[model samples]
Target chain A: MDLLSNLSLGFATAASPENLLFCLIGVILGTLIGVLPGIGATATIAMLLPITFQLEPVSSLIMLAGIYYGAQYGGSTTAILINMPGESSSAVTAIDGYQMARRGKAGTALAVAALGSFFAGTVATLLVALFAPPLTAIALKFGAAEYFSLMLLGLVSAIALAHGSILKALAMVVLGLILGLVGTDIYTGAPRFTFGITEYADGLSFVALAVGIFGIAEILRNLEGDQDRTVLGTSLGGLLPSRADLKRMVAPMLRGTAVGSILGILPGGGAVLAAFASYTIEKRLSDHPEEFGQGAIAGVAGPESANNAGAQTSFIPLLTLGIPANPVMALMVGAMIIQGIVPGPNVASEQPELFWGIIASMWIGNLMLVVLNLPLIGLWVKLLKVPYHVLFPVIMAFCSIGVYSVNSNVFDLYAVAFFGLMGYVLLKLRCEPAPLLLGFVLGPMLEENLRRAMILGRGDPTIFVARPISLTLLLLTLAVLVVMFLPSIRKKREEVFVEAD
Target chain B: MKNITVDWTDAMAGLIFILFGLLFGVQSLGLEIGTAFRMGPGYFPLVLSGILLVLGGLIVFSAIHDRGGEGVGKMAWRGLFFILPAPIFFGLTVRGLGFVPAIFLTTLVAALASFKMRPLWALVLAGAVTVFATLVFSYGLGLPFRRFGPWLEF
Candidate 1:
């Protein structure tokens, strides 16, 4: 009854005429960017961060949330039509989805992806409503030691979850931490790495770093290849799934929701991990495992559901504890900060309407995506036909404007260029920027808590071990590290990533 | 198998990290290094640099043990040339030339990065983007910037 009443309050806040209009606008724009390859929710959110300053906090949040899950829906559309993934999470969908398109079952695959995602979004919204209260309660009890240990766990899990060399990921994390320390010290009046620049006193601009790395670097990477994209014809066969398809989809969708709901709660786990993990789980459980990469309906159904579900539930940590589980959630933390809302344990008790309204808006956004995207699949496909040459300049122009608007400082634009080049160099070195981003987001928190915990323990450094919750988190971090190094499990993890790639 | 050599890219990446670590460590030496209970500005950074050095060492060592599969794929030299400069041009010109002309010039420069771009088409594209951006951002969003700058004053 308490949860029901809270949800009703959420609905009341979210269902206002203004909120609904913004939500619709948000989903449509989200789908537009998501349908366009090389642009992602992370970049889109970064670009739109300044606009949120103009609206009511609740409506702005609802719109951003719409963009997040709306991208998840639109990503699968491009995956099915073109062999290219519009978003990284939807890369898994492209394998079987593209195959289905080639075989004249594109309409059925799109329908399955849409329906499955809708079902998963509904379940995950309820899960968020159920779990957030309890998680916040646990978060309230966390001390400096527990917070430090939890961050360690988060960093380790990010490395364990990321593809490629763990050492490189570790290096990236350390580098990010160093870069984050460029500002003036929190405790002392001394500057750490400002190099006498006045703008460096506030550390790097998050929008610049994000737009440069994810947005600008990605555009550069995409431009490297020739523009030879072939779409699986405009004829989207029958949009309805057969009775057999429906029956097969049922178990996978339910299982995907379960897996996504659980994993999405973890610090390093989010929509991408949930999708890939669910796809692997479904393949293992399916009797026709061989059909997985060859247009199997279950292949499209499961991962799509899992990614949507995970996207919804990933809001849990951010909303409750102010800990971002992934880069997208990290951007959300930036948004929250921009709104003058301190993202932490007290948010639920402090801002009940804002908290629940976001949850309710997610459900509404999901419904809007299904309604708006199904008929507009053709439109998205047409968008894909727009060549990279024209599209990229427009993207770059917006990026410039977005970066400039952040602080209205020309210095930030320079930072964007610096990071864009740095990001490109990192990409050349075969390093993934995702884990580095998470590390950057969590860096200041980790350092502050580490110092605080040590001080509290009177420099003994055993306070982390003495506290039960802290010890447990540290142990989990250790376990993740050990498991990542294990040859057998390491091989399987590599295989999973390779398959998705 | 083809003669396996040290993974040069991995080695170089590791070297770059180690260099960064050393630089940070040396820089932190100038700052106050207080006790663990009461860390100064330098304490956390020094420790992080130490860890980075160790990680960088490990990566370099691992590079020696592996068969070099591929070097950094073909450098997006053209992309680097255009994309990196486009933003810099915008930053330099925005205050002097104003948002519209600055955006226009930036787009034109960026469009030239693509070999397929025709001069006429690029000009039209730039004009179209500038007008649309002016309408949306300058007018609709009211992002206070002059449509024409002091430099245009005759």
Candidate 2:
């Protein structure tokens, strides 16, 4: 009954006319960019973060939540049609979905992906409503030691999940933590790394870093290819799946949702990891195992459902602990801070409407995607034909205006350029940017907690091991590092990443 | 000397991290490095810089000896030439030239990154972006940007 009432309040908040309009705009815009190659949800939201500052806290957050999941929906469409996933989470979907498109079953593949995502989204929303309250209660009891250890675990897990050499990923995370400490120190008011620039006293613009790393770096990578994408030019035959196809999909969707809900809760893993895990499981379980790479219906359905569920449930950590599980969640933390609402457990109690509104908006946004996108498939396909040269310039122009409008500071624009170059260089070295962003967001909080805990314990240094929760988290962090370095697991990890790539 | 293999990509990446580590480490040492109970601003960063330096060294050591040398691909030379400067140009000129001209020029510079783009198409794209950005950001949202700056005065 308590859960019922909470959800009702959430629905009431999300269903209002103005909120509905903003949610709709967010989903549409999210899809539009998600359907484009080389622009991920992280960059699109980063570019749009400045615009949302003008809106209400609840509305801005609702729209942002909508963009995050809406991109998941649109990502599958490109995976099926062009053999190029517009978002990385949908990468595995391209394996089978594109094959289906090539065989003139594009419509069936798209429909299956949409329906599976809708079902998973529905289940994940309920799970979030059910689990978030208890998690928040648990998080509220945490102290500085527990918090510090938890963030360390998160950073280490992030490095574990990243592609290529774990050493490089660890290096990126430390670099981000250092970069994050660039502004004035909170305890002493002394500038750490501002290099005598007054404009940077408030710290480097998060929007600039995100847009530069994900946005501009991506553009340069795309430019290296300069090759045109081969869009499936055949007219889609039927949007409905056959009865046999439906029967094959039901079990995978269920299993995928289950796998996704669990993995999505862990720090540093989300939709991409969930989808890959789901696909691998489905492939193993299939009676016709060889059909996986050649376009099995389950291959498309399972990962699509898993990724959508993972995308929705990833919000659990953000809403409950105020800690971001991924880069997109990091941006949410940034948004919350900018709106003068500190992220974490208190948000659920102090601002019930804002908290629940985002929860309810996830389902509503998913429903809109299913209803709106299937019919608008033609338009997205047409958009795939637009020249790349025209698109990047427009995106660049918007990135400039958006970064400048945040504080009306021209210096942020320059920061965008500097970070953009750095991002490109990092990308050249095959480094993943996701962990770096997560580290940047968690850095200040990590330092604050470490200092506070040390002070609280009178510099004993054993307090981290003395406390049960902190010890457990530190143990988990150590376990992850040990596993990453194990030769067998390292080989397996490289194989999985190679297949995904 | 028969098999002196070094993954250049990993080596370069390691060197970049080392440079950043040394930069932050030396700077943090300049600030106060107090004790644990009552820490200074530099204490945390200084420790992190040390960790980073150690990590960088490990990466370089691994890079020098690794056999699976996945060579780095072609660099985006043309993109780097044009795209990196677009925002810098916008930042420098937005105050003096006003929002309209600044945005137009910025977009124009970005378009030049692609060899496939023609001059007339780039001009038309710039004009469209200027008008649209002006309407939406300036007129619609009512952001406080001057239509024309003082430098534009005759």
Candidate 3:
């Protein structure tokens, strides 16, 4: 009943021998994928989804959750030791992390990242346990109109946050929405865009889409360039951060945690935004900002802490409201559904052990990550030394097999190929795929909610504005759009976009 | 000339969108429903098509005023060659080869498309993947793999 007691029960469930072993396995696998370039948590989890079907619901969720956050921890290692970011979330880490590596402080940068992540994971897990209940209650007040409006805001924010031309971003989002609409309509029971295919009836599998876009497409992109773009620093030195490094990182870490916790709760921009935002804030706050792009320890510590914190707290919205903040969380929700556990407001009450066990497992999982990663850093650094020609094929093979295994249907394999081509084309055109994917995922829900609200109000659209929550969300969307159009914001956006290029 | 081509892709995308919208609108005509407010089979598709048409038109309009840089035809043909053949390979082999072998072969071919590799090595990797998949799917989880013909032997 009480917070402490519930957590104790959670610890009991999570600390069970079976759950602990699975948690360790999950983090280890997560780290391996994270260390290897081009294999992201989304594809990795999708590959593992079918394997988890036989496990108990609690065990399955705990393991999958471990992979999700564990990838965030592992992702920073690649970003630091190599210039390559394992996922978009770690892109900011590469900015200064790789710099630290070049300066022969790779050990210190990595230690800070690991320790900061562990600290953030502990605090965020506590926050999730304390805050989830009230958030679920607040989420219950949202009706179809409010949910639709919130999703609309999310789509807009995704487009705005995308580092590219607004027109191109908008186009990609619309394309994603069209793709999302391909499955049978839930409300009308009408076959949409399935084109007489049985497999399409369920819609394009998110696993296939993600694997094709992020994993397969990444392989294709990597192959076009040099095959041996290894990071410069290969030497492994001290494994712990110095006292001077710790003193400098404290303020940035705290600021990053605060920023990450809030932004992580938003849809479509969780860890990615947290890392970037923290880096910017840290640079702005630093007296010696010029040292950032060189080898600033604060840069490594802040973004790593923010990204990990963001990854942990992103589950709050998913667990409480049934809204997945990002694609990886969406896959997690899919995993929960396969286990016959509906994720929403009722999840905490109906399945307290499952919920709390997962919460408690985060602490244990974080501990496992530190132990697993610190010693294995030498090994991961060696992995970074492997030539890209050999690595790319292996990653591509995994992507193809992972996508194919999802449905036991060849159609998804083809779907992945098709999307991979589309993704490649989009990349060539300098169009960002992140907003597009977000839009696609949210589109069907947005349309369904919109239609339902309209039908309920007998075609009067004012019902959207009449609802306080919906009105507020709609206003926020408008404000963001207006701000984005401002000259100052536009200039800043262009700078960010250029830097990305 | 480059600017014209940039306009052309935007125009092409718009035309495709319009065509797609028309197709969906046509398809919606055959669906039957009971009530207006409750929504029929055609309602959502009809709405989507209409939105697509409007958005496509906007794209066309914006392309006219756009001053963006010249768009190059930078399509990666090697990537396309590797990716395009995947579905055909999957479709042809899945039923006969079964899921495990089918996936292995598909992955092997897809992996090879990135660059030149020894055929023997590819075959070995493919075989290893097949065995690993067989163990994971069949032995571990007990998903009945279709071993022969239309029916599963498991």
Per-model tally of clashing residue pairs: 0, 0, 0
The clash tally of candidate 2 reads 0
Candidate 1's DockQ is 0.76
Model 3 DockQ class? acceptable
Q: Lowest-scoring 10 consecutive residues by lDDT in candidate 2 chain A?
A: A66-75
Write model 1 residue lDDT over A295-317, tens digit each, in one string.
98888889989988888888998
> Could you tell me the fnat of model 3?
0.20
Regions of candidate 1 where Cα sits further than 4 Å from its true position: B1-4
Which pairs of residues have clashing backbones in candidate 3?
A: none
Of 1 and 2, the candidate ranking higher by lDDT = 2
Highest lDDT scorer:
2
Better of 1 and 3 by DockQ: 1
Candidate 2 Cα errors over 4 Å, as ranges? B66-68
Full ranking by lDDT = 2, 1, 3
**Predicted chain A of model 3: TM-score relative to the true chain A?**
0.92
| lDDT for each residue of candidate 3 in B64-112, tens digit (9 for 90 to 100) | 7536545636555675686556655866676777777666766677656
Local accuracy of candidate 2 as per-residue lDDT tens digits, A163-186: 889999999999999989999999
Docking quality level of the chain pair in candidate 1 = medium
lDDT of each: 0.85, 0.90, 0.75
TM-score versus the correct structure, for each prediction: 0.97, 0.98, 0.90
Q: What tens digits encode model 3's per-residue C-alpha lDDT throughout A330-385?
A: 67866776577877788888888988999999999999988888888888777777
Model 1 RMSD vs true structure: 1.8
